[model samples]
Target: MSGTRRLFAELAILGGLILVLAALGPFGSYATPLGPRLLHWALYLVTGYAFFRPVIAAGSALARQMGMSRLVAIAVACVLGAFPTNVIFVFAAAGPAWRSVTASDLAGAYLQTLIVGATVTIVQLLAERGAVPASPAPPTPALPDPQPAAAADATEQEVAPALLDQLPPHLRGPILCLENEDHYVRVHTLHGSALVLIRMRDAVAQLEGQGERVHRSWWVARRAVAGAVRQDRNWKLRLIDGREVPVARASVADLRVLGWLGDAPPAA
Candidate 1:
């Protein structure tokens, strides 16, 4: 499935699970009435998911930097995320009463929320690890007649293979862009995206002469830069495959130097 569809499906599953947990009254009784209690639990689940998802993503980046496997990084991130998520819940669920609560009471509440947070984390890990396979690539049109031997050899020599050599077999192809998220660099191509354990500076270096730095956290292949778009005073690049990459103010000169910022689109 597409990224947007997959996200919606995940949200639906999470919402259903939360609703079931609320109906079961797993905690037995709350100080508030049934209505408020249910709402409180729902809020706890939604807020926890919202806050920790990005935290875990950042953790994944750090883990990559540390040379850890993606799964291990995710596990560590989830464990670390539980503490902060529980703290948020304590105040959210307690509201006005939290100020009067003792340290011991707060600790107890945190412990309880931690268990729920851990459970949700494990569910997410499982879902990610067991992701469905990508669909087959679409058919391409037939190529034209082969070029002369010398010309073909020269074309092959011009295609530098340094970055492609580092990528896994499936991810190898013409690169489209690189997005830095925490400690990991997300490499995008016509085929798909893969997260590599490389800092933004390092990734940009590997693409030298092939791509240009467009943002502090982004690099785009010159060949893949289809056009530019303007949003308010800011600018973004439109990639060949339709991904919109943000262009930093400092890098505006670079794009202009390449003639990419000519006739900027109207702000939306």
Candidate 2:
């Protein structure tokens, strides 16, 4: 899914939580009128999302470019973002007078928003991760792996993935795999490789049953695999073009489950 659709899906998930929270009425809000309490929680939660998410997402992207952990960046952004978001929440909690907000009260409110922000961030991240299955183009009748003689027929019938359209005409042939290089992902096609100014995750998400990420920085098309190479406890996918893409140990079981590893042998 594109970012906008993903955002809507995430907000819909949040909407469900909002309904439950409003019904339960936490934080001593049970005494308030149901209508006002629902509105208050919605404003507080949604505004907090608007405030923290952009900064956190940007910080995570910058961190990746800077060769830093996104978790560290998210922690920093969530903590720092809490201050301003808390201001909005404090003002929204109109029962407490502005003048009555003591330094200790401000501190407590800050702490509360920080915790809530972190929780919401975790939920949103999980939502995006869970949304992967919703991507990929609609399923079509599976075809046999391409062969040299059938290449022309396959090309004529195959609906090109949107991602390949970004490549140059000459390089828009069979996709082998993707390799990440800092800010860009190098698209390895059967014709030749070229760098595309798109993130590896986004590129993989755009693929329509052509490939999947078998490693943190690599995505491989199953049909392009020549064989698997074992290096002691490590594993690598040897492609038809003689390129070896490292396979993450964690992804080994998934590959085995999908029949990428012939007969579901042990990962190691």
Candidate 2 per-residue lDDT, tens place, 13-94, comes to 7787778878998877789999998997787778778887776566656554444556677778788888999987786674
Candidate 2 segments whose C-alpha is farther than 4 A from its true place = 132-268
Strongest candidate by TM-score: 1
**RMSD (Å) of each candidate, 1 decimal:** 9.4, 12.9
How far residue 5's Cα lies from its native spot in candidate 2, in Å, is: 1.8
lDDT per residue for candidate 1 within 129-195, as digits (tens), equals 4554333332321112434544633442356355455556654555668877556677775566766
- Alpha carbon lDDT at 111, candidate 2: 76
lDDT of each: 0.65, 0.69
| RMSD score of candidate 2 (Å) | 12.9
Model 1 weakest 10-residue run by lDDT: 135-144
